[model samples]
Target: MSKIDFLVIESDAARAESVVAALQFLGYHPQRGEECLVAEESTHAWRAVYVGGVADAAEAERQFALLGAAAAQVPLLAAADSPWAARLGAAGSPFAQRMATIAFPLRYEALAEAMRGLYARLLGSRRGELRFVGESAPMARVNALIRQVAPFDSSVLVLGESGTGKEMVARTIHECSPRRDKPFVAINCGAIPAELLESELFGHEKGAFTGAISARKGRFELAEGGTLFLDEIGDMSLPMQVKLLRVLQERVFERVGGTRSQRCDVRIIAATHRNLEQAIAEGRFREDLYYRLSVFPLELPALRERLDDLPVLIDEFNQRLARRGLSCVRFGASALQALAGYPWPGNVRELSNLVERLAILYPQGEVRAADLPEKYRGQPQPEETRGAALLAMMDARAPAAAVAPAPAPAHDATLLPEGGIDLKDHLADIEVGLIRQALDATGGVVAHAAKLLRMQRTTLVEKLRKYGMQGSLAA
Candidate 1:
């Protein structure tokens, strides 16, 4: 195997910036240019070292001695920029003169070249860890899809309401893919103003407009050879979509101001909640761009549909809040039931805010049902819960009537220690009966009956599965 690349050390913040720019331009991701150089040197046998300056002359000398003893595995380059360098040079380090003659104030272009040549010896590997940590079925499905798709380079469109963790999914794809070592940059299309959105995506040359300061790399440039996440992409205007479409079809794009076409190999992963088909029909979104982005689409199911994950999400949030020292708070049993019952119109984002608020206000005790937000209190059965909206959508043409209702007695009516039957079984039976009744009412049109049952179609499927009759229902 080829050896690892060299380390680029710098004295101050500005020097670090210059060196980093040079290293990146030269295609080497430089290790920390700070005082941790010796620690890193010990851990990852670097091929070469660039010593800009030591942190403190006296203390640095002591640290340097530790490093000199540890650096037997690699070559060291001590750029002569400090008084300490002169001292080290005089200490009979054999390579001191060869390193010292390279001028201290190296030009940017020259520094970039040198760093490139130094890194050319090593074969690059993917940089860091890629992880996904949710056990929910919806999340598991997303992870599975990401694993399946990560080996290929293609534009991906993630469809979901906000706070559904679309960005996490996008990152998981990039991290597992061949471009894992490359940058995974993200930009919010809706956050920036419309006029500024274009320049932000493609970047602009200096003096392109009134506020132009210096030439800058946009998210695309920063994500070269990697992935770019265009969040809330539906919010981008028609004109910008056209330009983005051009880049997708052809791997070349022009900066906002400069006419020079820069060719880049970057995978694009876009996300949005808006119905782009409707937008395209309305002449707001471009059809070509829609097709390009939707080449691989993944829809994230809403939290309400995955209510079984509520407990998992709450526990995760509790641990996260505890790290911030809001440790004592926990959801009461009733509070949890209340959370599961609510419609969660805002989905996971709403749940997160409520959890944070509970942690802040009632940090040391069980949060009571009363502590729950007013909207969720005193819910009716799911059938009675969702209003009359479903009554208006049914008709006579739909077939597939509900199967014969299993009587309430066949339910898991276990005789309790002090009672004749388990109430849980009784209630589940009632829910099952209600679903069957709704299906019978609608003649089994899932959508129409889902409205009548006052539940999501997916929820009804799960409920049927719990009773071991879901297969018949699906058919």
Candidate 2:
């Protein structure tokens, strides 16, 4: 009656009632159904689905197929005694990796445990889906590696360029892993000073150093039962590498001043822009430490290498900006072509920044090739130049046609005034004036005003809210 938290699909009326009772006992509201026929809206409302009393594995598979995308969005819980549950629980089974199988006749403890696991997994899946944006071959491989290695506690070494989103990849792995509910502590080894780096990683006891007035837990202790992301790890000093190697080997560490050794239960996920293998060869990084951290090395391809994913990445960035109440920007064909040709030396992070910058510059507007920063606009295509030249020649040979004089250049100021005005305020005033004029011309009809201004009605509504003009304007 109140929003359904769990949807139980069981053909057997007695088994369905039993599952519903168990769910209610666990403080969950559940609705029982004979088959998987959840409405589209209900799919989002429900937390998980329980499939039980299936005649055989074939029936279960058929039910699963019937569930469709809902199966991917929500966690699936199956009766352990069911014929398909055995196969579903098997290693490498796609369903087994995501679905939680609870033993029946559904003991409270087992059901609770299964629910807890599925809830954490649901959150992790959502996070992973949102952050991992690209579908390019390189990203597909990277995602596959994350899925394969996340379940295990093997140390992960993510290697990439400075802005290639190595940390994001590490976080995705941690989110997809069993430890998603735990703290994901991160520290940049390269950012901190060498002297302070050891203290930062291992912490210190009271009076360990001049600044240590109180005892503190290090990243190893703080990230217990979770993930500890050590970013830019290749820059760690040789001394620190030896200490880290010892911890990796022994799984124990002592505070900077304390004698008691603390056991670390943290999963190590280290990322670096530098080449650690080269660092090892150069005697900067220890070979043993490198070997320990590189147990499962993952290489992230640079943004330039995955050019096909640029549009998707840009769209993802625009969506993020929109969430922040910023107007989204649309890139034109020429702009996209220019972006594709340009080599993104700064990678995804740079693109994200660029998108935000464009949102601010051209809010709710289309961005042309000329609107882009000079560096990002690559040279014009030779074919385009040739076509233009041919058109010009043809025009010269044809009959002379009187062309109207070009309109005056917009905002024709050639120099800044000695006491410069607030350019943003000036632009805002101009925009407000134009919007008011559009509204007046359209008899205060917002839809007509938006059409006149060549913008979406929603975008215009947002502008009205932003400028506090909604009450003054008619619908």
Number of the top candidate by lDDT? 2
Candidate 1 ranges with C-alpha deviation above 4 Å: 1-133, 378-475
The Cα local distance difference test for each model comes to 0.65, 0.75
Per-prediction count of colliding residue pairs?
Answer: 0, 0
> Where does the lowest 10-residue lDDT sum fall in candidate 1?
117-126
The true-versus-predicted C-alpha distance at residue 91 of model 1, in Å, is 29
Candidate 1: give the clashing pairs: none
- lDDT value for model 2: 0.75
- The Cα RMSD of model 1 versus the native structure comes to 18.0
Candidate 1, residue 104: how far the Cα is off, in Å: 15
lDDT of 1 at 90: 70
